[model samples]
Target: MTLPRYAYLGPAGTFTEAALRVMAPEGTAEHLPMVDVPSALGAVRSGEADYAVVAIENSVEGGVTATLDTLAEGEPLVILGEVVLSISFELVARPGTRIEDVARVSAHSHGLNQCRRWIAENLPGALQVPASSNAAAAVALADGSAEFDAALAPPGIGESLGLEVLVSGVSDRASSMTRFVRIGRPGELPEPTGADKTTLVVHLPSDRSGALLQMLEQFSARGVNLSRIESRPRGDRPGEYSFSMDAMGHVAEARVAEALIGLKRTCPVVLFLGSYPAFHGEVTPVEPETTDESFAEATAWVAALRDGRA
Candidate 1:
């Protein structure tokens, strides 16, 4: 039997690949590293791979617009799981190179932005070049064709690529972390753990003043705890946007299901992204009044009343 294949943002030493490795483990699957987040998802969408792992958000940089936009506009895909990794950067250079020997420094845009203060304070006069990824910067240096003398990347990139670390612990914030999601073709949903989260996008009916407030009331009134909410343009018009939110329960939960039903009636579009296990291990507190049995009883009561059985 052939082992399953997984795709991830790559050139091998990327943080996305590291997160995927932890989820899939070595020898469990054939991990293929794609050049970008879209390509990783494309591999799975095209049936070339079983799943793709891509960065969804970062602690220091907010949402990864590339991944967010892709998930919203591209072919339908469902998130299967998520992984959160603590992040750090190292300034690595080619053999025999020192900080003084460097004329330019390179990193991915986010990498450079996260370490902005460090680079400005240390390199002083070096040019800042943006690579597709930090690992790509390492590849360029290894290829001996890069004009840059050093790269700010995950420490593992340097060790794996045989580069020397010129400076360590370089991120501006030590507590920085990133969240990555595993996506696959829409299929069987993951069995809901007590601790789970459901993600969705809500496109409002209009841009009226109280529209957003009204939409939020659906969750608040239902006591649904929203862990995250972000707005993005609806792509076809001006002054209109869609809200992406993550709530603290699975769709199977009565409270969450009711809230979504309310959102669908109130919004022009309600895209169900996925409901997966929360990586944080934080479970939603179950309420006695909103248990599955209670919801079923209430649903039956309404049905009987409509049939003239008060």
Candidate 2:
């Protein structure tokens, strides 16, 4: 049997790698480390890997623009599932280096932002240097190639890489967590678990007033709820924007399907990213009138009326 290949942001020890491990344990699949998120997804698109795992959102940073933009426009891919990991960083430095000796620190942009307050209060004088990833920063520090004296990396990684942990539990928010998705070429979607989420990218028909409301009403009228919705500039036009959303139901559900149909008729571009199992496995509560039975009965009523039997 051939082992599956997974491309993830790496050099090992990144949060994305941890997420991949949650999905596919070590020795079960081949892990390909990419320099960045785009490259990881690209590997999947080019058939270099079976799946790509990348971060989509963080509690403190909100949406990861790179992941959002890359998924919005690309050879179609679908999310297979998601993993949510609590985030905490460790200030790692050369062995015997004290925290006060650190003049510069390196981390990914999101990592820097997440630890901004912590860094301010603790390492007040340290300059922030950006790295491709926190793991990459740790790697640079370990290999003697880093310009920074210390690196903010995932917990346990510093020890694994033979670096000294100067300070642990570094983060502004105690409850910060990152959401990662497993992406693959579109094919059979995961079976509709009652607790599931459907992701999409929608371009509004126009930038006129009430246009945003018009787009949102598709889901509202159908009793579907949105768990997350963020707007990104279309880039083609100044005022134009596209929305990336995670609706709180599976596409296989009647309410979700009808809402999608409504968007298809109104929105100029509606991209269905995928419907996958929600990380927490909490089922979305359906309104009495929006149940599958109700939708089926409504469809039968319409057909009866058309046949002049009602």
Candidate 3:
């Protein structure tokens, strides 16, 4: 069978690139390489692609802005699954290039920040240019063909861009991870893997006191855990904000269904995105270029610590 195409935030080999790979290891996945998260969703909604995978949140950065905005688009583009990948970023450039010669390091803001310590410490004279996507920045370095070469990106991205690894595993925090979601048309939801989470965005009745609190209470009353909640400015009315929530229950679940009904009653609008599987992948980090017995030992140590087996 011909596999479905995935519209992701990439040209190829972004962290988003890795998320798509995890979600559909056997399927024929194609990169949509959108300008932003919104454009990627539009691809899924308009049938330009079968699905859109977006980074919803990061461990340190909280909620992703474009992903939050795109979640407001309602149906035909529902979040079906969430996959979390550990982010161990790397610095890359054409081989034989030195850090002193590197002038501008182009990368997605998040990627650059992950490697800020390395950049700030090593290339004090170089400027950090913010690009939209990690892969996008790598693409710029590849296409620009200028002295403006170095970028902090996923190793997969550097490989795809024909760039060489300059510095490996540069993120300040070792446990850093980004959560991504798979969005697709309603009723066409994928089979529920044990690991999954759903996303929702709501606009409460303007100034309805405790309306937000009430919905959350219902979830709490039912023992549903909320993974994330962020407020976006309700542009229609200045100073007011809308709630974007990422919770641990699916619409298919009875509690989630009840919560939605209660939410609709309290809020003026309740947007239901997809309820797909969450990433069950091992949180293992791979440094660029070098890998050995020590790598396996370190990963095992992290796993042991996570499981309280240490």
Candidate 4:
């Protein structure tokens, strides 16, 4: 089987790695470990990988700016599918080291900050060292490259590097989840699943005061529900902002297509951020089964064996 090439930040273990592990099984993916979020997206835009995934938002830390920035760049890539990963962080140690033995904590800047309240009370004297990647911090400990006794990393990564979990689910909030998206060339639009999502990076026309309202009205008029929307500076552009929006229905759907076309009229310009099959949108009692061809081939071999030895 020719698995889709996947890219994410890596040195071995991290939440992104954990997310990828559950989002797509091994052998079904070829991992690309980028130095940062932007670089991960670059891997897909430059044809380096079949698809790229990056953390966009986290329940604890809020937004991941780097991921949003790259998404706003809007190269030839499009959103193929989204994976919402339940993130559980662990404070790790080399071995036989208790939590009290730790004098300092190292982690990705944001990762450290997200667990700020807990760290403040439990390890008050410990210094905070923010690195580029959380897994890289773990690597530092395993290789004795970092002087700190422990660092925070995704459970999967910490375990992978032969580290012990000193603290579990340290996020101030439990059940925290980070969202990731799989991106590919725009031309390679994912097939319609009837269940789909549309994400748009839009810059409204300055001349209009109710530009955003009007954009929402378009979707509202179509009776389409907006799943998510985020506003970020367009590189801190003077008097300009970029809005990233997600809405129900596939971009190819007549109602969605009409809404997008109407939305364009409200903005000076809008970039389609790849409308693909939506995942993790609705909350229900049962998780919808994935119908991706490879999944079927693996589990429904008889159904997949159509003309073969059946």
Candidate 5:
């Protein structure tokens, strides 16, 4: 049997690689490390890999703009699963590199942002440089290619890469976490787990009063709970925007299907990103199965009567 191929943002020793391990353990599949999120997603899109895992959201940083925009605008891909990991950073440097002697520190933008307070307090005089990823930073520091004396990376990077940990627990909040999603070529969504989330993007037909409200009502009126909702510019018009939403329930459910149909009727485009199992915790059941069955039966009855059937 051939093992599956998985791509992630890395050179290794990055949080993304850690998340990938949780999804595909050692020896289960071949792991291909890409330079960035687009390349990872592109690997899957281009058939170079079976799936790609990348960070979607960070609790402190909110949405990862690169990941969000890529998924929103790129060729279709389906989210297969999600993984959430608590994040922490360590200040690593070449062995015997003193913190006081460190003139600069390097990290991925998000990692730098997450450790902003710690950097400000400890490395006040050090310049900040952004790398493609934490593991990239570690690699540079290890290879002596990075001009910075130290890097903010995952805890064990120091040991794995033969660096030294000058400081630890650098995240602003102890509870910080990042959410990653497994994406693959469009189609073959995960089986409904009773606890799931469906993500989609809605671009409105026109800007009008209560237009946003109208979109929300499509789900709100039907008791479909929304897990996340964000508006991004349509990229062509100055005032026009697109709404990205993650709502509770699988797209296979009647209420979710009805809400999507209503949204399609109101919006110019409704892009179905994919429905997959939820993380963090199991979702509370939204509605009874019988309620959806009853709604489906009534809809069929109405369609039959419209055809003049007794």
Candidate 6:
């Protein structure tokens, strides 16, 4: 009977809030709006919320470094699921203000990047002022605390907050989308959906030339395809780096499990973020040699050979 609590980057009308709505809907869960992504995730880590929804990647900006770095360290949270939302922005300003009157625009860093070309072509003279979030920028404008004249905010935020929409559909790429994940304290993983993704953070055993290749081969040899991969500076040393990757299969699958085992033996640090349902729901095609049956048969064969049964 108690509603689940969800902490997200928000002041109400943010893309993260929208993603949370997609997962929990209005009145279904308690929404706790944090000032930023780290705070949102921190709320979950502190047991202040049941889950946290934050953006991990954007089509235009690629990986969201804040989310990646935060998830890579800390108390260890697992992704429960993901939501990918098509991104679109609205140029909003005070009711009496016009586009030409805007001298400055405020938006989150990623928002600014996605709308960079549009902003350049349309608001050529406007200076970009980065805010913690698009919704925060809108909130600042609405509350008369903003130094910027306009904000690049999610669609509908202008109307909801009593701002004027100077221009709609503001984005360099029409197909731009951001991927958000629902994160929670590590616990029982979701049942393996055929269409799933397993996320991980791996630190190479050494800085040697072949170390990276060896780490990647664990998945490659097991027929586990990687959907996304990025290297982040380990920060402990200048030459060291860690990889954050999304492998295109559930950890429950044989190929994925074997690949993880190989990484455990080779990599110095292998962090299993989680195995969750892919937002797109596209099932990864498994090769015949990598099927669960094949793995079982191979194991049996190895056991038979050990027992001299051939």
Writing each residue's lDDT as its tens digit, candidate 6 over 98-192 gives: 99898999999999999889989988978999999999999899999999999999999988999999999999988999999999999999999
TM-score of every model versus the real structure = 0.94, 0.98, 0.80, 0.83, 0.94, 0.98
Which 10 successive residues of model 1 have the least lDDT summed? 283-292
Off by over 4 Å in 3: 74-76, 145-147, 159-162, 188-196, 208-211, 280-310
Residue pairs with clashing backbones, model 1: none
Candidate 1 whole-model C-alpha lDDT, 0 to 1: 0.87
Model 5 pairs whose backbones collide:
none
Candidate 5 similarity to native, TM-score? 0.94
Clashes per candidate, residues 3 or more apart or on different chains: 0, 0, 8, 0, 0, 0
In candidate 1 the C-alpha lDDT for residue 273 amounts to: 80
Tens digit per residue, CA lDDT, model 4, 79-133: 7778887766789999999999999899997788778888999888899998778
Residue pairs with backbone overlap in model 2: none
Quote the RMSD, in angstroms, for model 5: 1.8
Q: Candidate 6 — which residues are off by over 4 angstroms?
A: none
Estimate, for each residue in 116-139, the C-alpha lDDT of model 3 and write its tens digit.
776788888788888878777777
For candidate 2, lDDT tens digit of each residue in 157-251?
89988999999999999999999999999999999889999999999998798988999999999999999999999877786789999999999
Flag clash pairs in model 4.
none
* Residue lDDT tens for model 1, 1-310: 8988899887888888899998899888898988888888889889999998998888888888778878887688888899999888889998899898888999988888888887878889889999888899988888898888899888878877888988899987889899999998888888888799898988887878899899998888777888889998868878678888888888888888999999989998888889999999877887777777878899999999999998
| Candidate 6 RMSD to the real structure | 0.9
Please, what is the whole-model Cα lDDT of each candidate in the order they appear? 0.87, 0.95, 0.74, 0.77, 0.88, 0.94
- Please list the Cα RMSD from the true structure of every candidate, rounded to 1 decimal place: 1.6, 0.9, 13.2, 10.6, 1.8, 0.9
* Residue 187 lDDT (model 5): 75
Residue 198, model 4: Cα distance from true site in angstroms:
0.8
